[model samples]
Target: MLYDAIRFQAFHQDMRIAMIGVKGVPAAMTTGGGIERHVEQLAPRLAGLGHEVTVYVRHYANPRGTKRWNGCTLVTLPTIRRKYLEAIVHVFLSTLHALRQKYDIIHYHGVGPSTLSWIPRVFAPRCRVVITFHSRDQFHEKWNIIARAYLAWGEWTAVRFPHATIAVSHVIQQFCIKLFGVKPFFIPNGVEIPSASIGSDRMKTLGLEPGRYFLGLGRLIPHKAFDDAIRAFRNVPTAMSLAIAGAPGYDMRYAEELYALAELDPRVRLLGFRTGEDLQQLLAHCYAYVCPSRSEGLSIAVLEAMSHGKVVLMSNIPENLELIDHSGMSYEVGNIQDLTRLFTFAAREPALLRERGERARHIVKLHFSWDSIVRQTDSVYESLKA
Candidate 1:
């Protein structure tokens, strides 16, 4: 088991819960990004809280056909597996299947999956429906106008239709209130502070030297702006390498663009789709972590990086700023020159990086624990009962 063994909390009444919308968990077993990472950490903790948790996973994402993981029941289901159709299609089937079960809570993870949240509300009148607004997906650059409009409706239904709505960020919480007149329970994403340092065997395999390379991690989508990170790193006059870890998300073209940009400089290495011990080593040993994403709700990656005691150089987007509380080094969004300066600074200034990194990790240790987040989510579920 990758988690610490905590005895079941007997104080809270055990509730039957079904988690929908993420690709799968453990995130190690799936090609999970943010939502998968969220569910991966969440489901097991909820189970340890004395709740019976069932996660609906797409078969395409988890091919091994595992039956159980981390004290939670894994119900693997089939999906269409297309770029646009996979998540929604899997969610539609999962909702129908989950409604038949005697669950106390049916929680949906993202705005795209929350479109079918009404099914549980109408059919399973006794079961509480909870939707987490993980991101404002309608604003993401990958969607066509038709898909964007549908996502807009999904966002509307997410807040209004659910029995209780949870927003991962204050920015998202406020957006729901201003646009939909609904106030959601604010629960930021959680991270586990790694108790022990991982060995550098994985790092050596990837040609990454400890404290020598900067790390950028996330899926290779257009909105993530990995090209910006590559372009910026190319301008830095140093031997320090840039190690970017992620796979092509919804579009392959964007990955091609990143590859083309990386070809210009040998210092950039795109290590694809790392998770588990491999990923932890990257976070634990890097000089700093980079998140060049253009959109987010609350980034698990950023929190995880901070939890590993690494300074995060994120784009100065509202969500990123909210997570770091202005404690991190921020570059102007999509400004290669500005990001280049930060990259240059990372090469030049090790002492300041260590100080900021320590403070950032301290903040995560004090504020964002999975145990606390599970309790807050349980409170929301209990509120639905009344």
Candidate 2:
């Protein structure tokens, strides 16, 4: 009573934050991907900075209405999940739920769900809406004509509606500027650089011998061009085997084609999804990590490989170029011949592989650490609050 009679003071503190996307924390963690990894890292780190964070996710597998983990609250909303296109419906419902919450800032990921952005303008006009355009997914040849048009429209809406936009790579920023007339701030993905460790024991558990394999890590999608890696590896020295690590989800047909392509060839092994220590072990001990993707937006798999100090042979997309140039190591996109030559070169000169791996590690340390990325993202959040 004495203190209350003395004085009254206002307090300025960190803002309440909401991250809106299709996936929640534990689901995202269990199913590893770029967007999931981004949320898993950024949300908790933002919470640690004294900001109240609640992530809004689409209700897919979660029976629970809400859950909490690692100091972050996860709110799931009801939505349809018939096809991939239904993600928009899910995101829209999730955004509506987010708008009902007392959040100072709302951050949305991806451009598939255009209607989701309207929530901030319609329901919570005062709250700042920040959208991170993960990638321009329609560019891939996999999409049919109508689907591409729909996605393009969604992208347009996503760029136009947000208070601010974030592009995950320089390539993506340029694409958004060119296609949607939106100039987005660039924030590349982050990776945790690993300490030196012999991953032979872990590899042995996966039925692979130490130092006897090359690794390809990513979803078995058509654009990833896993078949190109297999064709290229035909030119590699006999001793080295190729291990493709990723789940078959969007492109089961592509997976079937890959299996058919490598039917009799024991050199290529499709080791479907491997996470945790299994993935880390593969990255640590592989002769080299190959990313044969025709298109990318700062690949998390490549960054993971670099983090483990592995030599990377990637396609010559601008995103890959941004990470590693042609001088030390790289191959032209969709060029089986160039990839074959690079593979042969890596097999013949083992010392060069080690040298390039060290260089890759150095690059990751300088540019891709999670701490630096989190700080950069925090600065972005601060800018919105201001």
Candidate 3:
């Protein structure tokens, strides 16, 4: 709907944009994460706007070959697929490749990849370099001390090297100002409301009774804290099931722990990696959506849930609090007892939860329109040329 409101001629002609950092477009659609989803949504739309868009994707990730996607070109590069080396290796190669291209805007995603953003700044002096600070990656628990230190350094490079910077949330913009003494442009992530009906076929296959399960979606990472949500659900004395829909992200031990926990309770269902219609149906028909993250940069999962008109129960982190006010309930971050009590209250009072769900939808519709995000991002690219 947002696309319908914008004029196609607003985009500048013959402008070239090279997006590095994400795995790829169609590949990102399969592996559901914030950065991945952001690329999948924005890249094709940017190509549709008459810009020459080229994305550097990993060879293994983009299995469908290097075919052009929706007018955008995909350049597959090689990378060692190990957890620590994957991003570093891929980004290094991608940055080197981007330096040789005739691009107007070279945009990088995440602070880690932004560490190399200065490559284009020094080599391709005529091309403007841009980086989107998606999150405070240094705070993620999975990284080692050395990697954490490097990510912190990456944050420093991101603010200084780029011609213009974009922060996905206001919290991240404030973070840039407080830490780096620079204020970056704020352009939050956006989500489309699902148009598909809540079909009962997938529900029956998953042994789910429509609206009887609480939904948790996103990558199964330690920082996400889905374990706390599971523990909290155990305390709630209800017949409702807890369905977690996600895939593990290189943390085998954590995944093992989660699988073990799921086995303890028959009510807990570990629905690994639901996408497309299955994912949309789960979001469309759920008792409530739970997010127990310790850190976030405008969670796309939370936004998608809100867009689906589902009640959200999240932690009191600054990023989550920005999107949810009295419209949804929150507990102390990492406090199991507090979250447990909140879940019990929500399960018991379904009517009250539905009221909040309506408010959540209204909040997303007013604030996080994808059309507005695209237009704002286009303006940022145009300003660089000016």
Candidate 4:
């Protein structure tokens, strides 16, 4: 009954598609960050294109909610809350639940969840299995030896079991080909061009001014290197402040370290977890967006910043480089001294910075449109169907 109206609209083409592995939909509407956002944009658009879409979200993420998102159905399943066990356990239960759904496509996100893609392949042999390799999860420093080993196995399963695989970046696609000899469809993540501008009232509330602060947005994980931005900001001899917006993602110790470091500098504002309009406001109004991450799987935050017409400063990792197209600045990955120099340069050159921001926006709009991404993804599903 929840999606009754949508069901009627979509009755013409009931191509049942199941999206697994993400916490929830409407990325900015949910807490799962990038992967959630990826599904958020893709699922509803697919539904609009006349497919029956169902996104499996964890129970804790939804708690009590309607089964409908945009036009896609949400199936909330329960899972353990522990850091290491949560994803694997929820993915296991979701895969079991999906086995009975008789879907045309079972699409899994993240390498961690794709480890279980083999289940649907074995049980529901008729269902097409697809996994989107968001990143090399095992590269994250938060995981221990055993955890890394398990994730590496998950990556192997991702390449081996899926009927089709999607790589969010060219770097990831090449990695898959080299390791598994399997070519994945390259479907870059998409960003929306803002139609209307919201006034800076929200920025005012946060004691932030438009085009005055440098923004760092993403999870407060070690690999993200928010600390590098904080330290670099400390040395920049300018009145501009550094606003870091994100929650600690299963790395409490690292989070605590960042907070303590931020306290040492009066200019650093550790605004935890800004999403939706709050996130948009910061991205729209910032002087420059800094991504000091040592690792990435084609960062959504960076693309979003570029979409908002902000200059992006990132670590020189291959994934981050792929997004810029020579429109942004990069430092040596994990080199704080180099980041400090970049920050100082960004502070000094305002006209040049604005020029870069314009180029950044142009590149993202040209290369990463949501409509194009969804259509390409739909083609993958169709290929499997044939």
Q: Per-candidate TM vs. native? A: 0.95, 0.90, 0.96, 0.95
Best by TM-score: 3
RMSD of 1: 3.3
Off by over 4 Å in 3: 1-11, 27-30
lDDT (Cα, tens digit) per residue for candidate 3, span 1-386: 56744544545555799988997776335454788788888888888777899988888777768678878999999999887899989999998888888899999999999988888888999999999999998888899999999999989988999999999989999989999899999999998876755676789888788889999987788999999999888888999999998888887788888889888888999888888778888898889999999888899999999988888899999999999867889999999999999999998998898889889998889888887897788889988897
Task: Give each model's whole-structure lDDT.
Answer: 0.88, 0.77, 0.87, 0.88
Ranking by lDDT: 4, 1, 3, 2
- Candidate 2 per-residue lDDT over residues 113-146, each given as its tens digit: 6536877877898898888888777776577787
Collision pairs in model 1:
none
lDDT of 3: 0.87
TM-score for candidate 4, residues paired by index: 0.95
Please state every model's RMSD to the true fold in angstroms. Answer: 3.3, 5.2, 2.1, 4.4
CA lDDT for candidate 4: 0.88
When summed lDDT is taken over every stretch of 10 residues in candidate 4, the lowest stretch is 5-14
Clashing residue pairs for model 3: none
